[model samples]
Target: MDLADDALRDRARRAGIAPDWTDVTGQARSVAPETLERLLALIGADEPAASVPPLVTGMVRQAIPLPSEAGTGAAVLVLESGERAEITVHPGDDGRCWVPPIDRPGYHRLQLHDREITLAVAPPRCFSLDEVARGGRMWGLAAQIYGLRRPGDGGIGDSRGIAELARAAGRAGADALALSPTHALFTAEPERFGPYSPSSRLFLNPLQADPAALFGQGRVAAAIRTAGVAEAMRRCEAAVLIDWPEAAQAKLALFRALFDGFDAAAEAGGGLAEDFAGFVRAGGALLQDHARFEALQAARLAADPADRDWRRWPAALRDPAGATVAAFAAAQDREIRFHLFLQWLADRAFAAAQAEARSAGLRIGLIADLAVGMDATGSHAWSRPSDVLGGASIGSPPDAFNADGQNWTLAAISPRAMVETGFAPFLDTLRATLRHAGGIRIDHVMGLARLWLVPDGMAPTEGAYLTYPAEDLLRLVALESHRHRA
Candidate 1:
């Protein structure tokens, strides 16, 4: 390698970029210098020789590196239970603090002088099968949530279908049901239908909602006829492969009709009106941003078909919290509310499915699948731009199977931003996936350690590894797992 190449590689290495990696077959390979340059550029590293600062910085960012061995320090430790005490750490001691043993496990706070940091005190391990089953072996069924079909499912498999399937599985002695990622997908572009690439892991796919759950079967049938898509719906349901676009259109039409009816009933003080209001209130800003994005994308597409990607959207409208978005939401209130209503229905259906599974005697009723990352053009990235990296994609290094490597085209969370936010985005994602589910299966769990990040429009092999706060993330996961009994 020449001087410039060496410089670029050195800079990349300093930034936690892996220049060489061992593949699945244990074969080592070195990445090209050009790849490293491209990746560094995408991450806004224009100066190759520039120094990279510590990921966590600022006054509120000090961390007490919690090693197995203890250290001496005078600090005030605040337990999660609101109990506080002054303590002095001793060198070479076991993992015990100076205060009384913390029985309740959760994230607490530590104040040393003028600095304060988060202290995650977790149990030795998460709840295990050995404790739950008492040495008994348990078997369960894994299912694709969208592929579960039932009569009158409006061409797309839904949570109602899963609930019915759960009943059957329970009767056949199944104690658990693992499901595919039910993460939210693009409502505006149904062609981008992939369970692994979701718009937001925090929300459920509105398309997977069973209209019958909210609107009665009779009402759904009437709406289908009113929308004049009965034939299309029938064709979608009977097709061997899922005709996503056709099915999505038909289901969306039906949802629109359902929304109209719901709105009328809500105005007339219907029984579910208050519940819907409460759900909206609970969803808060996150739900509002998603709904607003969907509405804006729809409007933009209607005007110009090329306006699908939010990144290319007009400057003012791009920011979710900007005045432009606020004005748009104000003018398109009904449209935004419609999207919110869809989420409410989806949430109800999924919760009902989990309830059905548990009621049918399943111990681990619903196991949720959490995707590794979100699509770059999707709602989560659009809403939390600060939390996600721009102009970069999460991918894998070249392996024996594909010497070219793999590009997932998904945006990864920025470690620097994660630290600044105290891992709020990560915690929210975990909590959302755990909601209404007995357990969660993390896709690409290895990503917690390090991720291969490729520059936008570059080949997968043209990328480098970026380390994450794995220890902190694992501690949070363990705490959440114990709390959820997952």
Candidate 2:
């Protein structure tokens, strides 16, 4: 049979699935009887060897539903000659592949039939935040936050305001303050309006830096607070309206004032020691590359954002792995230190708030929202192109709220990649998000089963439904939730 022949062409045609087999078996595009036999046994489709999918081997998303009470997330399977990912049980929703960290980059998988295949299992490990079922007396103030604006904040509250709001909410009934994601937004023109959908989850928005708090002394903050205390209060009252840029500018002022403190801390730690060590340990060469990329970005701010690729920058800064790249990396070392300091501070403050909420006899202080994926142009996509959805975007088919359905341009982790990579990054993301929350609200929970992926260059409506190992993915989530009590 022709590998590109559409066996189910009649039905698949309606769903936008074509017989094209261009990307699957790249160079060594030939089927081997041996590997095919192994795969047939794995999927329990060995009835007639002829029935197995021909070694068209491109990107495979093999999802095998593990034996269980069916519909539960649980499974066991090896990749194209890799470690076995087994989920003994399953969880409720999100029975698909686990999510990964935003900073992690690249696709790590073994090639099969000269193609990329994301292996999947039916009995996939999965779970929800409430499944762990642990609770503490904690209450956090959840609010929408923003940064600078062209109209000078234009009534949108900034990070300085957010910190103060956290302080106020803590003083009130809340033990902590959980604001919208403060991930870095695009610095160029036509700023994106959505906060949940961000430009970069790997980095914080500089708009929220609170420059005045950092740069100005007690005098400057006091000046803003005292001069227009009522105005600031009114601004907070009009929450939900976020102006990213202006808020970023105000926060930068505060950040600049307080930067000395960060400097002092780094100095004490001995020359950006902790952050550098942490990045090396966590992200490996990719992390190093990302940090270096950021440094290069800062130096070449003069260029347009679209043309900011280091390769196209100054002659001295062309190659990402060359001398210019090294110099840029060195310059960014300081910024990296500052970024680490900020994250540490944020974590401690949030954790403390959770603790205080617990003390106050509250239940469910911090409920983190886990997005389905990341932004295409953001840090996460840049790092791991393999794990991320390249020619597709995850979205809804047709829902009541959106008759046309919604096309969330956020990037996604390919199911096939997860099974092959042992779901390492995907599993890590779940572990991280749940760690800080009393509970989590997984957006688009249905993503566990099937994702409507709009093929590259196609309109959202032209995508097809791709299924995953719902049971196995969920079971893994349950396993992790149970293990960590998250």
Candidate 3:
């Protein structure tokens, strides 16, 4: 390579793009110059003026060096618990000063003279299995949530089935019950059924909700009879292979019946209705956005099947913050509430399963599985486009098993956006996965360090390894693991 090419590769390397890598076959691969340039532009790797990043992360009692400009400023450390610690920036002989050591592990703040940056203090490591099992090795069972069987599940698995499995496993001396991803999938097109390619990792798949978990079995029985799907449910249970579309339709119909008279029950007050209200209140805008997207997608699909992807929708409706979306949400108020009700039921159902597991003598109870990516046309992409790579697909490079490489067609979290947005998106996703679980299993955990990203219309083999803020993300995971004890 010439000097110019070497210089270009150096720039790419400094920007966290791997200009060269070693494949599984022990062969060295150099990224094409044109490809590196394109990826650099796509990732916005142009160097910015020296400044504090949105987040700084380190282990508890580990002193972290700040940006050059921030090293000499007067700083105050603010703990997450509303307490303030007066600390000074201690400059070293090398000129860079270190933030005072934080003894606590949490999302604290460092108030400097010019800027305030979030200090994510993480424990030394994640919660250890030894702590949960009390120094003994413990075993657990893994399950696919959809394939589980129980009476009255409308032909597919539901949270009630999972609860039963947990109880059984706990009795058998299992310490954990790991399960497949419960991430939300498309309710508009039930045929697109895959756990990994989800609509939103922030929410649960409502189809797996067990109404009887929250409402009584009597209410569920009445709703099933009222929806007139009793015979259909029986046939679904009798099927050899799961008919995902039919099962989803049946489950939606049952949920619809329960939602029909929900207003009356909510008005009656002091029961599931009050609990649902509390849920909606706690859910806030994020929940509202998901519900609105669900309702809007279903409506558009009903009008014209071609209107599947939100990107193709009208310019006004394409923007979640636009007036058109507000108008649509206002018009479809009840429809939006129906989606919210589904989420509430799903959340309650999963909570019940975890409760049953822990009560049945399991040390860890349930360990949730977090998918690496979401569908590009899904709710998360529609609502928060900036949080993900806009036109790229996350995939794997060529290896012994796949010579041509593999494109997963899943959207990836944008590394640049994570730093620019203070890692809010990643933190939200991590917390959501750990919400009701004793632990979490991250699919493709290697993605935290780097990912193979194929730009739209590009061959998978043409993709390059895009580096991520591995240390910062790991520290965030450790912080959340301690927070949730997961």
Candidate 4:
């Protein structure tokens, strides 16, 4: 981020001190585009390797997969930790997790699980090891069948309903079924909307749980539903609104009753529990902790928002130091365990739905969609604040589609940092996304080439294009796409 443009800096200083009543906040002056281009060309040939190496060294782990998109940086890379790097790849034009961080400085001896591999790095650039195949066919469903058509099957469609949909898909000669983002929604809110923007992308939305999917299979008749449970479900589903609160409550209660069934049915060829266990393990302790925080906040808010929210609570309580907050956090943690269990259930349901599509013999099993950004206050931000910049949202300039630019207030990957570090977090996110999905559709696919980065308090017109390493990104994409075969 250093500048060789002395005159530009001088002009900026003058702009800052201008006595003319023009507020410079309205004026963000970098070099003129053409002049900047010329300067870049001139400096590129003459610039010392030392000057450019920092950007490469700044890579979190100094490694990323080669053959990523032709960005200025790595598309994705693997670190020694076997975790992801800050980079991302085009990944077969499908949305799925791509993995990264490579060794930097001299040679790196990597043992992926059991196999030993080696790599070397230079001052500003590093080498990468990529395993890529040409391409392969994929399969999956794109829609959550239950989400559509509010049948008379109470307000919510249970598992039976999903099965019926799967059967229907088979009949229709479709192979796969993709779903809208089914990530859990906040249970407390003014009808928390948008499932894609989740309270926690790692967990499932209990509202989507259909008791009929679990328990109602044997006992309950079609018309007569469980009194308390069904009634809550109806209330949750009745509104024109999404009804996250009523849905959460009804689903949670129904799950409590079904939990016994889940444990008992575990050995009966039902692998949902096991799948969920894998999911929990895959998320690692940090992900679990974040979900626990969501549970705590939701429960305390359920008990009382005034006592729970920082604005109304005592100073220390508002802070993590308050005794009451700790007690509440503990209680909520108990519920978090429940949430984790339910996550397994929902996940099983999701996977089952995918399998159902496969049995139907579709080309793709599940095609998931990834929004470009997430809410700043959400768990993703709370856990990885550095990866996600607050207050600053990701958006785009006005194009032919819409004259007014779009502001996806949700946090986006810090493109520069991500590319340099081989997109570690980005890869993790991709892996989680692609886990169940057979194919992924990255909304605003154009973002991979260049992002219109707008600093806060700036207009869309003032935004500039941040370059990415296109070739490397493409190579990583090819490698990961082969890995997923989508």
By lDDT, the best candidate is 3
lDDT: worst 10-residue window of model 3: 43-52
Q: Which stretches of candidate 1 lie over 4 Å from their true place?
A: 1-10, 23-27, 41-76, 88-101, 111-115, 268-271
The candidate that achieves the highest TM-score relative to the unseen native structure: 3
Q: How would you encode candidate 2's per-residue C-alpha lDDT over 1-486 as one tens digit per residue?
A: 544433333324332233222222252232223323322232233233221221111112333322122223343433434555544333325442221111111122322223323332221233333333355344466666543222233355455565455445655766445556554444332255466665445444454333333334454455445344435434543556654444434444444445545566555685344653464466455445544554456555545556643334566654555776676567577775555444443443445544544454434444555667776655455556566665456775444466565678776776655665666546756665665455555667787776666554555444455566565466556555545544
Q: What is the C-alpha lDDT profile of model 3 across 1-486, one tens digit per residue?
A: 999899999988988889888888899999888878878887777857336787888889878887676756567888999899878887776777788788898889898886888888999899879878787889999999878977799778988898899889988999899999988898888988899999999999999888888888998889998898888888888898889888888889889898886766787887778899999999888889999999999999999988899989889988888899999999999999999999999999999989998998889999999999999999999889889886888999999999999889999988888887889889989988998899999999999999988877888888889999999899899889988988
Point out where model 4 deviates above 4 Å: 1-147, 150-163, 210-216, 219-227, 234-245, 259-279, 303-331, 416-422, 456-462, 468-474
TM-score of model 3 vs. true structure: 0.96
Error of 4 at 50 (Å): 14
Total backbone collisions for each predicted model? 0, 90, 0, 65
Per-candidate Cα lDDT values, in order, are 0.80, 0.48, 0.88, 0.50
Reference-based TM-score, model 4? 0.63
Poorest stretch of ten by lDDT in candidate 1 = 50-59
Q: lDDT tens digits, residues 311-421, model 1?
A: 998889889999999999999999999999999999988888899999987888889999999998889888988888888889887777778899988888876566667
**Tens digits of per-residue lDDT for model 4, 1-486:** 346455554433232211111112454344334333332332232233321111222222443332222223233344435554444432433322222444343323333332322332333322211111125433334455446536433454544455566667767766556566655556555255575566555455655644454334554333233334777666655766545555555655566656545555666755566665677797676557555556755665767864333234445444343476567667665566566776665666666666666676655656666666666556555555556544455676566675666665555665444544445556566555666666667666675665554445655544444444544444444444445655
Error of 4 at 153 (Å): 6.6
Q: 2 or 3, which is superior by lDDT?
A: 3
Error of 1 at 410 (Å): 1.5
Task: Return the TM-score for candidate 2, rounded to 2 decimals.
Answer: 0.59
